[model samples]
Target: MCADYLLELASQLEFETVSACDTRDILEQLLESLAEHSAVTDIPVDEVVLANLHLALHQLDAIARGRGRPAINIPFHVIEGYLLHGFNVKEISELFGVTRQTIHRRMNDNGLRKSDVYSALTQEELDAVIGEIQQSHPHTGYRMMKSFLQARGLLVQTTRVRDSLRRIDPIGTEVRALANRTLRRRQYSVPAPNAMWHIDGNHKLIRWRFLVHGGIDGFSRLIVYLSAATNNRAATVLEAFIGAVNKYGLPSRVRSDKGGENMEVAQFMVESRGENRDSHITGRSVHNQRIERLWRDVYIQVLDQFHILFSNLEREGMLNPDDEGHLFALHWAFLPQLRRQLAFFMDAWNLHGLRTAGSQSPYQLWASSRHHEDPDQVEADYGIDWEGPYGFDDLGHQAGQVEVPQVQLQRHLTEEDMARLPDPNVHFMDAIDIYKATLQQLMQPRSEVDEGGSDA
Candidate 1:
């Protein structure tokens, strides 16, 4: 009776000749008609036979939809699991009793291709790992992300990491594209740690401007020092340079932009070397690309994060831009935090391994190179005094502040100190005059009383 019933249903639907696209619809119609017109007792329906018929229908539907070959009823999810577990199309075809073409077609149609570098984990597991990596290092690229994961004992391929990044952190993907677009193909190298150093300033903050003067060793990319100051004055630049020199002798050559802020430092370096041989003052900022690139990392790690917070606070009217005190107050609140964060970033950057540098950190590279150089020849070449604390009395004197040894160790100079610092050149003098004028304008009374009349 079940066979007779099935044959009757097939006759009504013409199942033998139905196109693939219309198979699912036709099958549904047949089932509905049978349910409506026949009773279970009349048809004597058997679950196994009905299931086989449904499987056949599904296979026909898949073939008609151009998803795979006809007469194969293996679920796409099962095939995906096989591919994910290191099974190839040929093996899967033999296992499923289907041709390799059918397996390939099904896999491609269902988006089950193993496009990533082989990882032993399931898709869900890989996604979870990628998500964790993105959360930890939001600005890191796929290569670095893969390294970080490998460090955690998960051997993931770079291609897989890139795919994960594309799915989970599209913004970072775009950021990477923009970063690469701006890259120049120039190559630079140095033989030793103190061969050359690059210095620059960053002004990415809104209300208050801060100086980020840092030096990167040309050979090892070791960060000599990263200092923040309230103003980008010549003295501020010198202070940062002195901080680096005090810790690790002088660089043979110092490089910086032609900005007036670096003029005095450049002069000092040339004076120390007793010639222009050690000073590289270029008009183009890109020539100091080493330090310029360092700023990009700081922008991602520090400036951009704080900018978002401070911007939100400003929009909410909690911070008053009109009040001069508000600026210094927030500076005091934020600059110390920024300094601490930058110190951490410096240590992490110096210690983190780089593939190009033979998988050694900048510090390791510098240390190894230092071991090879003769101490006397090195000291003579750079002419480093290597004596008592490198003096920054000039900064204090020029800024009209008492040279306090203890305060010198502090991260930032007081606003009063910055205000008293002598203007380096005509442009600085103009800025000072404008600032004074603005203050005077703000301090003037808004309303005046008449001499012979009551207050109006």
Candidate 2:
């Protein structure tokens, strides 16, 4: 009766029951077939049913079909771990007592295979790859380095690259330090290149007091113009502003700090856009953080090194303090070199890839956003020579060459003026009293005096 029942059950389950000596053998074979079916269909068997199958197999001494229990009972995660470590299907099949086909199917289901687990690159090879990336981008952290490597068709894990960089790249340390010092203030967004402009001056070069005035586009951070002069006066600031406007059309708004040097620029902006519109002057420099942050980069890349060289030259007497000839030589010879270096720095800054901008250069970003800019906002005569006859040489006048109108002077001091002066030999308190009294006497109304004579 049991054999009949087993055969009927096997038929219902779509499997042919093998002939056996007793009910136990028949049950063991049936359980083995069920396990195989479960593995094939990837449907988990209930724990009560699985336990019953294992008991029936154990009773018949069939738990070890080839080497171990069926693959259906083993967890898929364990199999995946072995596969990731370079284990092949044949080996795994033997260990789990599963067919090669079953192992392969399970591996495919788990999204892994022998081919997916290649041998990791040697430490030396990883160092070489990291070194090359560091040479190009010294400030790149481990994650950026990984991106850079992948972009060049080299597949490497970020963890491995980071370990290799710590061992071989020393500049990575300084890069991290500078990165920490970077300001984290929020910045205003602009839709187009010429939407807004930020301008500021850097005066860190102490000995020469060279002021580097620069303007940058707020949207793209592209340096519009950079100039080095002896002072941060109104004329110097105006020249820089006009030069930038001539190159990149007028910005919708100009932003700067409320300093005397920027007064002329503020006036120009007011005159151009009308007083009802936005003013050029912002709050303090801390509020204008874009251009203020750029000053740090300029100091680190150019001004600091130049200051060191200048100090050494001065110590060696090549740059004299009192000699006017030496001063002229310093200005004519070294100043031009500094300006050339600044130009080179600006070129590199504009062309180099910025990680914040998706590895695009500032110039590239600005060029891409050009179409979105408003044509009406741009000044039509922006490129005109607005600085005509403004410089000293263009006005055809040398220093102190302008004539001054003459004014007549009093021939002598009156008695009241003489008495109001402080006595040289008096006590400090008495001198203060006499000075106050004399000031009061001078403040009183003065009697009329003839043009050719003293006061009566």
lDDT top scorer: 1
Runs of candidate 2 with Cα error greater than 4 angstroms are 1-187, 317-325, 371-456
True lDDT of residue 413, candidate 2: 45
The CA-based lDDT of model 2 is what? Answer: 0.57
Write the residue-wise lDDT of candidate 2 on 243-324 in tens digits: 6765565776777766677778888888876675563645445455567656666666567666766677678755643443
Where model 1 places Cα greater than 4 Å from the true spot, the runs are 1-137, 141-186, 371-456
- The CA-based lDDT of model 1 is what? 0.59
| lDDT string, candidate 1, 1-456, tens digits | 233344555565465564545656766776666566447425433333344457768777676677785566566766664444334577567655679999878877776666642558776788897786455347877655664565454556557777888888898799998987786544455557776777766666624544556778877888888877677677877887876765566766776656777777788777765563545444345345666667777777557766776677678765555455445545545566667656656765665556666556676566546422322222222422122121111133211112111112112434643453333233311433434433333333333212212342
